[model samples]
Target: MSFDKIRDPRKIRHQIGDMECDYIYTAGVAGERFYIALRDEEKLLATRCEKCNITFMPPRLYCDNCFTELASFMEVPSKGVIESYTITYFDRDGQALPEPEILAFVKIDKTDGGLIHRIGEIKPESLKIGSKVTAVFEAKKERKGALTDIKYFKPA
Candidate 1:
């Protein structure tokens, strides 16, 4: 068996990984209405299942348990606990970042799934496992539909 990435400049994808395939993946524009409460509004959005009344943070289109359409979107505050975290030294492509990074799993203030954001202010060696953190967002004029619209989490 040979273990080598493509050695041709003609190939669009010069490397392949576990989920890599011969296809291009892209997403359409994220509608502004869907994130108004989260970015423009500086709040969280989670859908509640009409059938089971189950609320989820970072709102989904369907409920995990009832398989019902999660249509009731609610606003969740920007507060929560740092349930877990890891000091990252790599980028999305797994290469070492110029500086070490702190990634934390923050359980949304009042939801089931946790929000993953970079924990700011605290150093990699100083992050506490169960510490508290809050979401911080950029100014409204600079806001976008992306996650970065909310700045890194800081001590609350």
Candidate 2:
């Protein structure tokens, strides 16, 4: 039986309901080490692909370009340049926030990849594409080996 041709909308049948399921997710080897460094040392880690000579922040286990195993890791500076940004007046739930938040994609120095994080400590009007920013980590006792370990990126 061939299912590719669908000419009539009335011929289609569907069910609409919530499908509930539970699952556990683990951050594999590369992610595990990356999060550990962020939580323990409040540092940024990047993986280098010797074959491609590319460094990826939020380190990966293999090179995206050549599929080479990325076994070399390096610590990159917590500072970066704002490559792009957005200002949102509402929260994720569509509720209005007291103040708009500025989110930006910060290109970490010396790495080919960057992280998307909230940009704080400045007004949205003052933000620019090339603005320098630094990661502001949560207090030592508050870190939990997650991206949230860095509360936000602030103007450097």
Report the number of the highest-TM-score candidate. Answer: 2
TM-score of each: 0.72, 0.87
Worst 10 residues of 2 by lDDT: 7-16
For candidate 1, write residues 16-65 as lDDT tens digits: 64875697443222234346666667877766665675567667777778
lDDT of each: 0.75, 0.92
Candidate 1 contains a number of clashing pairs equal to 0
Over 4 Å off, model 2: 1-17
> What is candidate 2's lDDT per residue for 1-156, written digit by digit as tens?
665697764577865578899987899999999999999998999999877989989899999899988887899999899999999999989999999989899999999989999998998888899999999999999999999999999999
TM-score between candidate 1 and the true structure: 0.72
Mark the 10 consecutive residues where model 1 has the least summed lDDT.
25-34
Quality of model 1 by C-alpha lDDT? 0.75
